[model samples]
Target: MSTIIEQNQSNIITDNGLFPSNEVMLDLKNLKKVYPTPKGDYVVLEDLNLQIRKEEFVTIIGHSGCGKTTMLSMIAGLNPISGGRISVLGKQIKGPGPDRGVIFQAPSLMPWMTALQNVLLGVNQVFPHATKAQRNDIAKYYLQKVGLEDAFNKRASDLSQGMQQRVGIARAFAIKPKVLLLDEPFGMLDSLTRGELQDILIEIWNKEKITAVMITHDVDEAIFLADRVVMMTSGPKAKIGDILDIEFERPRTRKSVLEHDDYYKYRKHLIDFLEH
Candidate 1:
């Protein structure tokens, strides 16, 4: 049995057996991933556990092949878990659901679809009850929010890399997902474009207040966007190495974060973890 308590305007669900509190949006318990190879079973992640609170933004950082994407895909229900369980709001994840939205390394938009059409594809699915005009407005609003107002009718194939990603961001957010899973969404963009998109992402996240988990190899990016930076140990059996909480106040800007006294300290810690 589970208990629901109202605390400080937040619903905290507690089950003496499993869930600790309702404030927890995503919970991963004793998670494991194993690949069966002819040589033997290759374990990628073992005994991984994590909890993300509602509306919190967490970033995962690790060297290449540390199983960051594997963990994220499990949470998204895109991949099968060999052991343990993943739950969102106390519901065990079995497969991909609309409750989780994903932005991959590539935008992954339908090239033949116009930006508006691509976004509408998701908006329509999520808001099936919304009237035609209402759904159109919802899609347009998010597109404009991501600075894609002028690119609304442009085909995805015709858009620049940065522009396509903007559409991806807009599409993911427009669905009003409970969790936004990002797998190096900006990895392929130019530095300037990446910075611009980061700002856009943060601004929208601030307004939307969605719980987010992102994977980044860039320490600065991990620090800039995360409320907590989760470090992973190097793989064949990668697990959480450490977690660093970013204490800077939100509605944050790159300029403000960079100038903060703890900025370099946080950067050094993340870099040191990756290097050593």
Candidate 2:
């Protein structure tokens, strides 16, 4: 049976929620992804493994079609692994669960639902045992946390793409998931709005201390948000090229990220890998 261990080794709980092990939050071992096509079989990811410590923010960068999203999906349990092993919070991922929440390339809000309702759905589903009033309070708390209070009752269609993404972010975070799997969370936003949300996201992460894994093609974004950045090579079987430690001062501002001496050094390394 899988064991669940907190980072400190003091709060170990089992998979059944009793005996948590002291394992890292995420552990991927010799992970691989392959596909069977009529032409034969094509490998998309080759022996890709990653580990994430609790409360650490990690960003993944790669070329288009480089299996970055595929890797994220595997970690989120949205798709099955073709080979190897993955465990989150001491348990092997069997499928999607409340422990893992995903914000995809798009906001993916239900057009028919209001912003409040969209955010409400996740909490309600995950915390069914809680009282109606308890869930309501939790849902609204997260909605306002993302600055969507003014549009709380408005339909999702009424919100701009960036605003819709706020709801998605609120919803994913509302459950207090141990893992936040962000696949280009701000990819669709305008540059100004994207920058705004980046600050907000960092603030929330600091407060919540959630373990976050983000997939982005933007090197700057990776440097700004990640404690570590993992770069992947081009596909036909993409694999990790290099792992970088951001090593910036805590509570990093955008200016700090841009001004840091090693900022461009790491950025260039990622750019060289992607540009080549």
**Candidate number achieving the greatest TM-score relative to the actual structure:** 1
Model 1: C-alpha RMSD to truth? Answer: 3.6
| Alpha-carbon runs more than 4 Å astray in model 2 | 1-23
Model 1 Cα lDDT, one tens digit per residue, 1-276: 022443534534454323346678998888999999999999999998888889899999998998999999998899999998899988898799889999989999999999999999999999999999999999999999999888889999999999999999999999999999999999999999999999999999999999999999889999999999999999989999999999889999999999999999999999888889
Question: In order, what lDDT does every prediction score?
Answer: 0.92, 0.86
lDDT of 2 by residue, 1-276 (tens): 122223344655434342234446887768899899999999999887677877889999988899999999999999899998889876789988879999988999999999989988899999989999999899898888888888989999999998999899899999999999999999988899999889888887888989999999778999999999998888978888889988897788999889888988988888887787
Model 1: runs farther than 4 Å from truth? 1-20
What 10-residue stretch in candidate 1 is worst by lDDT? 1-10
TM-score of each: 0.94, 0.90
